[model samples]
Target: MRFVRYGAVGQEQPAVLDADGELRDLSGVVPDLAGGVLADLPRINPQSLPRVPGNPRIGPPVGRVGKLVCIGLNYSDHAAELGVDPPDDPVVFLKATSAIGGPNDPVIMPRGAQKVDWEVELGIVIGQRAKYVTEAQAPRQVAGYTIVNDVSERALQLERSGQWTKGKSCDSFAPMGPWLVTPDEVGDVHALDLSVDVNDARMQSGNTDRMVFTVPAIVSYLSELMTLHPGDVIATGTPPGVGMGHRPPRFLKEGDEMVLKISGLGEQRVTVRAEG
Candidate 1:
């Protein structure tokens, strides 16, 4: 089941698409898509609300995102492409909770920004509170998965020479979800194919089959460091072919369009514009 949050801020509704892909309101049944309510997703009949006419403004499925954890270079080829060595353990980082944004929304390039790059990743949303969860028990803790564009400002990230958070946590930096594809629908998160495109040209592409640290390993490792709360997200990391890996480093400019997709999940097209 693909669950979503839509409409204006105060009036937003928790919704789900039925078997025929028709939107049905879930707000009356479940309060919000956050806090991992889908863990024991209650059986609600589909005919409960008015039929949705068309696609509405899709917001990030999880409301009240706590902290966003990210893994860097989990993909082997991606590490090699950037001329960096794959670490023995997960390379972890954080994006400010304020960086969250809608998946198909415009990506505003920060002013005075030189290199705003794009990374396509498989994002994981934790459903249960997990601490010291073993690899064997990791799957039981995850709520579902979604397609994510880890849109970054390279200069803010690298040129500053501080934590990656500087460039990674710009407002509207985290664009997540057209749908949160449940775990059962996305078997083996480490083996999916993910890709990104700029305009009509293919830019970055690869399969998750080559991740240095598997999904379960990452979740287990992270849990040991900090409590993994429901509504918190983890970007499983991107495959090879990011603009940063290029010699000249192809980056985004105003008016550019981005299309990103993950298997079994949906796709989103984002247009780049100068931040107002």
Candidate 2:
């Protein structure tokens, strides 16, 4: 089932896509799509719910996000593109929850931002609390998967004195979710194809199979450091073709449009705009 949250910001209601691809209101059944509601997704029947009359605005599928964990350079090609050796372990980072935005929302370029870049990543949504779980146990704890555009400002990320969070945590940086697709519905998570395009030009194209550290591995690795809770999102990093890796470094500018897509999971379209 493809689960969603619809309506205006801060007032999004839980919903799901029915067999015919119409939105079905799930507010009567569950308060919202977060925490326990996500864990209990299998118990809900989307078709039994009333259909949403029209094309309501879709918001980020999950709410009250506890954490937005990220893996850096998880794809071998991405690491290679940056002229860095692939790490033996996952390169972890945290994207502030405030960065979360609707998949199709406008990406606000921070003031004086010089190198705003786009990364199309596979987001793993945790379903159950997991601490010290093995890779074998990771799948059971996964609620689903979604698309994440891990937007970054290269100058702040690499040239600044502190951590990557300074560049990664800007508002509207993480545009996520047209739908949260359950693991069962996604089948082999390792085989999905993902890509990114800027203004209709293909920028990045790679499959999850090229990931240096697989999904289960990333989940297990993160679980050892912190308890993975339901609704917590983990961006499993992007493949090659980020703006930073380009020879001339083609970063986002005002009016630039970005489209990101992952197989099984839906797509996200974001337009770039200067911060208001």
Writing each residue's lDDT as its tens digit, candidate 1 over 1-276 gives 677778764356788877777888887788988776756654666666667667788888788888899999899999899888999989899998887877888888888987999999999988899999999999988888988788889888988879999999888888988788788778877778888999888998999889898888999999999999988899989988788887777999899999999988888789998988
lDDT of 2 by residue, 1-276 (tens): 899999998899988888778998988888998989778785567778898987778899889999999999899999999999999989999999999999998999999999999999999999999999999998889999999999999999999899999999999999989999988889999999999999999999999999999988999999999999999999999999999999888999999999999998888989999987
The C-alpha RMSD of each candidate to the native structure, in angstroms, is 1.5, 1.0
Q: What's model 2's lDDT at 177?
A: 95
- With candidate 1 superimposed using the best TM-score fit, by how many Å does residue 11's alpha carbon deviate from the native? 4.2
Which sections of candidate 2 miss by over 4 Å? 42-44
List lDDT for all candidates, in order.
0.85, 0.92
Task: Point out where model 1 deviates above 4 Å.
Answer: 9-11, 36-38, 45-49
| Root-mean-square deviation of candidate 1 | 1.5
Instruction: Give the Å shift of residue 155 in candidate 2.
Output: 0.8
Instruction: Score every model by TM-score.
Output: 0.95, 0.98
